[model samples]
Target: MKILLVGEYNRTHWNLKRGLQTLGHEVLVIGFRDGFKKVDIDIEIKDPLSSRFLKKVRVLIYKFFKIDLLAHSVKKQILSKKDELSGYDVIQLVNESPFLIDLKCQLEILKWLINWNDKTFLLSTGPDYVSVMHAYNKKFRYSILTPYFEGKITNKNFQHVLSYFSPEHKKIHAYLTKTIEGIISNDLDYHIPLIDHPNYLGMIPHAIELSQLHYKTPNLDNKIVIFHGINSKNYYKKGNDIFEQALDLISVRHKNKIEIITVTDLKYVDFIKSFDKAHILLDQVYAYDQGFNALEAMAKGKVVFTGAEQEWLEHYNLEEDSVAINALPDAQNIADKLEWLILNPNKIIEISKNARAFVETHHDHINCAQHYLKKWST
Candidate 1:
């Protein structure tokens, strides 16, 4: 099959491309590097006017001349690559809005993609209309919008949620859903909201290149190392404050027996390298399923404290929590769980082995690619 994956969100599409190629399918990816994380892509779409000075100039141009230079630039790049993007058997958009440009420009690109591809699919990897509606309807126990509903989040955070629920975005979602052949979710967090969609294909776990990651048996002799990487922008959304509070209490009580490391705003490569030796990785606290970061750490044989909600457990028909520690949003509970891991170091080793095994069984890139191929074929 000839597949073109549009956009990326934390190397998900890049890893999927690797898996598809291993299965003898030709895959091409086109998108920006996704901020400072610098995710890989086959064809690069540069956002050259995103710098501070250029942004100011862009704003002035729009204010006086009613011209959006950034959108113009992005549209130009996409049009220039028109010939190469055609005739794909399948083109999967990583999210509802795959381009960096505004909605008008995004729709322009989507129109071309719909015409060029035989079949198109949407991946529910991030916030989208249905997911936002699900949260607003209180479908999940809790979601990224919980803080907003409780009035505990900032205007900026609330506006982030509003983006998906807005009238314009809703129109975009409707158009995409009507045009696309199917929707595929990468995890339970995304899957729950799209369960009722008429064209929903099914959920596929995030594809991790298990072969690329080196699994190590966690050493239990020295102080147990615990690492938490934070993206400052999503600190509140990710419940980092709760994690920090828990870590603070744990550090005070087990300072001699444990080493707590916190890194803020590191690039993807540096983030992984920084916690290479850590025994436990603290992932997000308010999710119903693990994200790419947690899954990658699990592939490295590190016990991860992340979303292992009962729904996720039941989805896989698992009877145990051997792969990850289910992290709740309470500070005391989080600290207690960390303390328990500290007291019972042997369990860390056991979970580490189970973690790697879980990734191999469920998230192996090649196997996941096969799953995708089957879904696309249908």
Candidate 2:
């Protein structure tokens, strides 16, 4: 099959591409660099207004006129690839707003792509109308919107995420939900929102190429090393504040037994390498399943503090704190979990082995890719 993966979220598409290729499918990824993450791709979407001069010109044009030059520039870039992008056996968009551009422009570009492609599908791994609305309406106990509802996140800081609830964004969602062949979710966070929808194709776990990931039984000889990686842009959304508060509490209590490492704004390659010496990795606070990073960390045998809620636990038939810790929004709750690991170093080794085994069994790229192949074939 000739597959076209449009857009990427954390290395989701890149991993999927590798899996598909290993299965002898020709896969091409056309996506952006994923900002500071520097995610690799076959073709990168370059920003026409990336330069200081061009950005200034773009801002001035948008300030006076009701037009955004930057958005149009991206739309033009995608549209210009019509020849290269057409006639794939399948084209999967990473999200409703793949390029994070103007909503109307997104609808236009996607509609154009649909006309050219053979079968178009949407992946619900990122923010979309369904997930955002479900969380906004309090369907989940907590979500990325928890900070917003509690007034911890200002509108300016969360405008991008909040955009999914807008009328324009909803229109795009409505169109795609009706037009696309189906929507496939990567994990439980997204799967729960669309399980009953008619076009839902069901959840497929995130693909982690086991061959590429090296698993090591963390050397818990002395101090328990804890690594906290923060993306400055998603500080509040990802519950970094809660993770820090939890870290501070445990830092004082286990000052001698624990070594804390914090890093900010590292690129994708650098960020993954940043936690090599650590036994535990702090991922996200409010989640029901692991994102790409948490899954990747788990693949490397790091006991990750992430989403391992009942839903996830039940799905995988695993006990709590067996493979990964369930990171709740409460600082005290997180701190308690950290304290448990601090006092019980053996438990760290236990979860580390379990984490690697879990990823190998459930998130192996070939298995996940085969799942996608079956879905796309249908």
Candidate 3:
């Protein structure tokens, strides 16, 4: 089968392409480098004039002539590569707004792509209209929007959620859902909101190339190394403040027993390499299931502090506290958990072994690709 994957989220499409190829299917991916993270893609849609000076000029041009230079450039690129995009057996969009363009322009582009493919699917890799609405409606116990509703987060942090619920974005989501053949989620966070949709396909575990990750039993004889990578832009959204506050208290108590390493705005490759000696990785606290970062660390035999929510645990038939430690969005709870791990170093090795085993059983790239193949075929 020939497949085309649109958009890249934390190398999700890149790994999926590898998995599909391993299963003897031809796959192609097209997306942006997504800034400093530098996600892989076959064809990149460039915004050449996106620098600070150029952006100011673009705003002036748009205000005077109603010409959106950035959107125009992306649209031109898509049309230029129209031939390569045609005749695919299946085409999957990572999200509703896959490209960095005006919503109207994005909808127009997607309409053209829909006509070129036999089947089109949407991936719920990040928050979408339905998911945000669900969170706002209190459909789930807690979500990324919990803090926003509780007044614990700033208005800036809530803007993304507001955008999804906007009339313009709602139109875009409705159009995409109506046009796409099916919608699928890769994690519990997305799966929850999509559960009731008639065209919703079941969630699939993230595809991780197990062979590429090297597993090492961490040496916890001296100080146990704990690492946290911060994306400054979404610090509050990701509950980084909670983690930092917790770590601060824990550090004061166990000054000599633990080594805490916190990095800000590192590139993807450097970020992963920086944690080589870490026994535990502190990931997002607001997630219902582990995201790409936590999954990658788990693949490398590192115990991760991430979302191992009850729903996710029950889905895999996992017992409580078996594999990954569940990190809540409370400073005291997070601090207590970290302190427990520091005091009981032996549990770290056991959890590390369990983490690797869990990834092998559920997230192997080849197996996940096969699952997708079957779903797409249906």
By lDDT, the best candidate is 2
Best by TM-score: 2
Selected candidate, larger lDDT, 1 vs 2: 2
Clashes of 2: 0
| Candidate 2 TM-score over all chains jointly | 0.97
Candidate 2 deviant stretches above 4 angstroms: 51-60
Candidate 1 per-residue C-alpha lDDT over 52-80 given as tens digits, one digit per residue, 9 for 90 to 100: 89989987898898777878888898889
Ten residues in a row with the worst lDDT in model 1? 156-165
Following a full C-alpha superposition, what root-mean-square deviation does model 1 have from the true structure? 1.7
Pick by lDDT: 1 or 3, better one: 1
Against the true structure, candidate 3 reaches a TM-score of 0.96
Lowest summed lDDT window (length 10), candidate 3: 153-162
lDDT of 2: 0.90
Cα-based TM-score, every candidate: 0.96, 0.97, 0.96
Could you tell me which residue pairs clash in candidate 1? none
lDDT of each: 0.88, 0.90, 0.87
- Rank all candidate structures by their TM-score, best first, as comma-separated numbers: 2, 3, 1
Candidate 3 lDDT over residue span 184-274, tens digit each: 8999999988998988999998889888788998797789898988988778778888899988999899988889999998878887788
